[model samples]
Target: MTLSENGDLWCDIRTLHPAGNHPALFLDRDGTLIELVDYLSDPAAVVLIGSVLEDIWQANKDGHAVVIVTNQSGIGRGYYRWADFHAVQARLYDLLAAEDLVIDATYACPHPPPDAGGPAHSLYRKPAPGMLTRAADDLNLDLSRSRILGDSVSDLAAGKAAGLPVGILVSDGYGARDAEAARVLADDGFEVIRR
Candidate 1:
């Protein structure tokens, strides 16, 4: 899939959805799929962790089209360039392709805090619903039936604002207990995946 200048990702819609009734799987990059780093510019920093493809494949098999929604504030922070970020994402796509679990699309927030302005912040960044709205429009997704798998509070907040019913949090073995409990309390349907 390719991200157009307008932020819409192009894909073989037929390959992704034949019946056109599949639910969408929204994933947070960084900590959820791979180990979080300071700002991964080098492709060598890309690491595939713990049956990532297997899990995604299962979701796809169960009639879900997987999409990645990430917040790349590093681009806005001037810590990393957008070209380098694309290079890393390309490498990630190539690696995941080897596992036979190609992602349908990817949506990233490249804006920084200054660009965000106020509490409205980034329209495309997590904790906000901009990217998710774009996803819904581009893919014709049903937000109430969508599932967002994330690794942080911001991700959950984004999903909530987007009206996603389930928010699955992947614990990184840190101070996740309180966060997990809070998630369950906030959304009774939320899940916590502990590794």
Candidate 2:
């Protein structure tokens, strides 16, 4: 795990070989991976979203890179520290390991969403595409064929903006609430994988 300058970005990379053209399965950490817990700062609260694991496992079997991209605003909002986030992440990895899952990399934007006048790019926050694009470059991903699965419109929108061809919205977390809005993006471009 490495921290970007200013310590607002967390990059944990474990890719053994750089395929350079592999399609990635980009998963959102909060609702899409573990069950959503608002401002989740406790490792004990970490629970895997059981259904998504099958897809991730299959992606692994298919030789696709598995990466997690998340917006951890709780760190920026003063609800938690980076250390807390790391503890939770460690627990998440342990749980995934128990299921025979391997994550190639994780890109977390620890900053909160930008204010109306603030530039989103500065923080690499979701809905901005910075994190996705950066991860693609770092992991040698094929964004044109990559798919991002998440529970928020921001997650899907970021995938679309980063040139991903498919966006998957899990029905858990905020998915049920943002369904209509997320579907609206499907009409614009990219396939929306509904769960």
Candidate 3:
């Protein structure tokens, strides 16, 4: 069966039904939290980024919901299957849990590119506010206070489109190159920090 045959949206809630209207730190998986690996599908290859470990811990302590928003195009493109994705994610969760870092929720969009003859560009992919907006509604989060943290310009674009006030572009993955283009999105209270 194809990835789209399973569904278009993938959501996993780790919290025991968290109360709504909380501020969230919407994080990206690959290149943002973990080391960048092109279409990574192996659990053993997972490696956490040390730079944001403290920030994640602080967000939890500060009463912010730690959420992950990822685009797993590899799944839809036949590079990996859902089981592989779960295995990789389980590794990530295990590593974070070891540090006492809890993720409130996780969302993934398994839409393939147009070349795959599918509408992967629907509402849930990055650069579009679908996943973030859905997370806000599902978790009852306040978008105005939420922040998107990723290494791509798409993260900043999505945050701004979602009306989020902050977007952190880290130099972990593609941030160093995307930084120049992301500078323009840092207006009207939508702060874009290129680190």
Order of candidate numbers by TM-score, starting with the best: 2, 3, 1
> Candidate 1 lDDT (Cα, whole model)?
0.70
TM-score of each: 0.81, 0.94, 0.93
lDDT (C-alpha) at residue 19 in model 3: 68
> Which structure among the candidates has the greatest TM-score?
2
Task: List per-prediction Cα lDDT, in the order shown.
Answer: 0.70, 0.88, 0.86
Candidate No. with top lDDT: 2
Candidate 2 C-alpha lDDT tens digits along 9-111: 7998987545667888999999899999999999999999999999899999999999999988887778898889889989999999999999988889877
Lowest-sum lDDT 10-residue window in model 1:
7-16
| Candidates 1 and 2, the one with greater lDDT | 2
User: Candidate 2 vs candidate 3: which has greater TM-score?
Assistant: 2
> Stretches of candidate 2 above 4 Å error?
116-123
Residue 132 error, candidate 1, Å: 1.3
The regions of model 3 sitting more than 4 angstroms off are 1-6, 16-20, 115-120
Model 3 Cα lDDT, one tens digit per residue, 1-195: 123345887888777435668888999888999999989999999999999888899989988888898989898788998889888989999999999999888888887656775584578788888889988887888999889899999888988999999999999899998998899888878998888
Candidate 2 residue pairs in backbone clash: none
Instruction: Indicate the residue-level lDDT of 90 in model 2.
Output: 92
